[model samples]
Target: MAERKATNKYYPPEWNPKDGSINKFVGQHPLRDRARKLDQGILIVRFEMPYNVYCDTCKNHIAKGRRYNAEKKSIGKYFTTTIWSFSMKCHHCSARIEVQTDPQNRDYALSKGIHRVLAEETKNDTVTSTYSMTGDEKQDEMRNDPFKRLEHLQEDKEFADEEKVHLIDLLEFRDRLASADYQNNSALRKSFRVILGLLLQNFCKD
Candidate 1:
């Protein structure tokens, strides 16, 4: 039985690594926690693109709504969080794209060559913007760029947060809350609790 078992063992004949049956598992290693470990040595984050990105060279599309295995790099540090830059190469054209983090608004902006399409903006608007951009101009209209200038936000500045929020929204929330009688109305009580919970949640996070 031992002799038969030994005889049944199969070894490759000469140099036959290309053989499918024997080489199926060869060089096929599964990576564990690849998304988290993609930052390599840097303590960066990993996120999939939220929108499709266009490759300038090949005129191809890198679809969004999925994790592209792209590594997010830290460009600078804020009070408690680090400002990040997410970058990836276009699959078709191999063009490098860099998207930076917006500090104040907690959003992202294209630091290099890419654009996010909003529901409000139309195809014509994008076409006009493309035509208007002559020399690979950077886009950071709504972005909070800390390195753009030497001073902090003021009324003279263009991208100022303007009291940290719009006045209309402040008035609206204030009016709604003022009208609500939480002591007498069950709905108002529930809403008050929910709003209190949200405030606490955001405060703890900050």
Candidate 2:
């Protein structure tokens, strides 16, 4: 009798469609904690194989295939929203990794916690560095200063030239609007009204 043919069966690994595979590269960074407070109560844990996972105590890369533990817990509140904190422990060196994510959006980035006073101070510094005076106040200063007045006149000339070009274009458009006979056709009049509104908006922007 002929020998029975060998039989083989193959089975594919199980995968969940809802929760996809974790990307270790993106998850390795500590999540921002401030985001959790701004967002509602949702959080996402991301994981990936580390290209450079240095040990906290020894400053060496954590070995691959080693198991690590991650923990998430509610920390405190910012305003009415609750903040959550996460920590990961390295299996080799007992190093603790910490990150924070927004509770509202799992992908939201965490921001540094700064009070309103500090934020205002920071903005003030930025404004002072970039601009010497406010718009109307600066114009008044230029009026009083001869050298600044001359500079302002030159700027005004440049602005007038740009406005002249825009006016020419607007005149051409008005000619087209006048040439179109909308008196006999109601639809044409409606279309002209829409175009006129757009042109007026453009003029306002200028």
Candidate 3:
């Protein structure tokens, strides 16, 4: 068994040192089965799905990170970036699926036998905007009105001042909590114990 796994491979009768290497002498690629499609410029590769997709034939969900033994080949070029295509079969059903690299969009695209599962946007998913001008009309009106601009500037300054005061208060509160005087207090310790006991009671009830 150890001999079978040895790095020193047994050379065939026809193999000669002048022939360069055993793989070249036998006219077989070092990758063996993986290089079967070498003539066609395709190589067998282990590919993982970049995003969630539904198998078109079976209508089954093939999740993102699902892996498959796929045939990988260069399909095209996108500004010096080589676009690759991966062809694989769905494990649920023997349906062929083709995925291609989308360099322009910096993502992957389904070419055949699979449909992308697009997540629906929700209110919570929407980004919270920072500015008060929620629309183009309001922005245009604000730009035209000097008084509104001055008011906006005043509001920004007030908000900044409030935030600064709040941050300072928080830091002072933290400092007070961390003080040696606070740590040495038996009254605070008893209060904390009572609070912890109440919390535990509430947690156990839940």
- Descending-lDDT candidate ranking: 3, 1, 2
Which structure among the candidates has the greatest TM-score? 3
Over the stretch 1-206, how does candidate 1's per-residue lDDT look in tens digits?
88887886455565365665443434331443444454463433456775666656676666776555466666787787878877777666667877777665445666776665444542333324522432212235224465542343342354446644677689988888778756448887789999999999999999
**Considering TM-score, which of the candidate structures 1 and 2 is the better prediction for this target?**
1
For model 1, give the 10-residue run with minimal summed lDDT.
130-139
On residues 1-206, what C-alpha lDDT tens digit does candidate 3 reach at each position? 88778868779998889969988988888999998998999999999987788999999999889999999999989999999999999999989999998876556778999987765622132346775324557667789999988887898899999899999999998888778675668778999999999999999999
Off by over 4 Å in 3: 1-6, 121-206
As a TM-score, model 3 comes out at 0.54
Residue 79 lDDT in model 2? 69
- Give the candidate order by descending TM-score: 3, 1, 2
Give the lDDT of residue 136 in candidate 2: 62
Q: Name the TM-score of candidate 1.
A: 0.36
lDDT of 2 at 160: 90
For each candidate, what is the lDDT? 0.60, 0.53, 0.85
